[model samples]
Target: MKKYSPELINKLTDKARLLRCHVVEMIARAESGHPGGSLSAADMIAALFFHKLRHDPLKPDWADRDRMLFSKGHAAPLWYAALGECGYFPKSEFARLRECGSILQGHPDMLKTPGVNMSSGSLGQGLSIANGMALAGRIDGKDYRVYVLLGDGEIQEGQIWEAAMAAGHYSLDNLCAVLDFNGLQIDGRLQDVMNPEPIPEKWRAFGWNVIEIDGHDMSQILAAYDDAGEVKGMPTIVIGKTVKGKGVSFMEHAIGFHGVAPTEEECKQALEELGCG
Candidate 1:
């Protein structure tokens, strides 16, 4: 694991805050998009795209690049924010989120967006797709890894367990799944909806190397990613405990913000809170 300097940590935290601002603001501009999960995932995605993932934004189709599948694609705002921040596209595209003729859709569309390795939002199918990619990499003798992000509620689907079983059975050491365990979903708390508690134990039972950490903590997130690189003989799942709407004070853990875009007034307030201009 790499020990990050205070300067590097500060930079990553700034990026995360910037991405969170972009997510909420862009959603506000479009007047439609998921904000809660998008904001909650900002720190982790910022760290991954800017500090960890092996890919060139200038060359999105580089054959040897690592694959990233966002299983919780409702958080398309977050994905787009990270991609834009990474230079996958111009920062100007952020304002067009969810608009007609915009590549940034309500959900990630692999064919429409660069840097999105696979389309998602149907919920639990992403792990299966990620498994296929990892298996293919092994068959083709490629060293590139596959990373997937799943929402806590999204795992309520039985298909998730099935995919987990497949990944475990194959001993896909190259597959790393990140669970954004923010507790709150669109409806209410995850336990009230469909409890997937004992999350780490469950993954371990599926033959995964489980690592639990604060999803918003840059240092822990970085360490988890590094640890994933060293694990062998099994897939790894990093369970990140986070708040529903992370940076925006009003939205944090507020279920109302799950799929509701902020109004212009709300946007101004959110930006003020995020220290964004």
Candidate 2:
């Protein structure tokens, strides 16, 4: 977790922007899928997949590699985008998203997706799987880490806390959790739907080292990642305050955009805005 050179940070940011563009394009083409949450998590996923996670695209089953569970499985577009961009699959597969026989579904399926560590999209179950992975890594004496992404709304699931308690009890310091705190969920504002306030304090109380930062700031995000790696005795939580539907003016902060796909014209505009059309 050493500091990333400014050049490396810039490269990560650029990759994140492309990740966002890919999410938009995939969703627009499929005419279905979650875009807001996916867009919000672009930088975080890019940082982990492209820079932090010790994963091999060629050997998806590398035993000692880090494990990443996307608990908010509706963000499959983003995950698939990253994996495709990472060379796990051909880029052409992105256009077939959600289509019959396509590996990229509305939610993640580990059995089908080469790089997906756990089948997710159940909303509250990913943390448990991540906990198991971390515990297994510890038992096997492996240095691999476990990373999970949770939605702001997904935190309302009581199981998240249950898993949090378990991680604390086991002192799984190798487990790192990232919350895409975009503040908006499918129905409306998360505060109105279900609030997860004092989020960092809650994690701290659960025996976690919390690092809160702007999720889109590559520099701060990378630094926070290094900070998470340095902690001992407990898990680390990163409350990444991000903009829902980031990089697209119309979709930013709009709850309606959560599960809606962009129109052809909108996609063009969005891609143009991201400079990746």
Identify the leading candidate in terms of lDDT. 2
Per-residue alpha-carbon lDDT of candidate 2 for residues 1-277, written as tens digits (9 for 90 to 100): 3466889988999999999999999999999999999999999999999899999999999999999989999999999999999999999999999998988877999998889989988898998889999999999999999999999899899999999999999999999999999998777887788788978888888888899999998988998888999899999989999999999999998889999999999999999999994
- Residue-level error in angstroms, candidate 1, position 85: 1.0
Which lDDT tens digits does candidate 1 get at residues 1-277? 4687888789999999999889988999999889999888888888888888899999999989998889999988889999998999999999888888888888999888898888888999999999999999999999998999999999999999999999999999999999898998878998998788888888899999999999998999999999998999999999999999898888988999999989999999999999997
Error of 2 at 69 (Å): 0.9
| Model 1 steric clash pairs | none
CA RMSD of each candidate after superposition: 1.1, 1.2
Worst 10 residues of 1 by lDDT: 1-10
Cα deviation of 244 in candidate 1 (Å)?
0.7
- What lDDT would each prediction earn against the true structure? 0.91, 0.92
- TM-score of model 2 (CA atoms): 0.98
Cα miss at 137, model 1 (Å)?
0.9
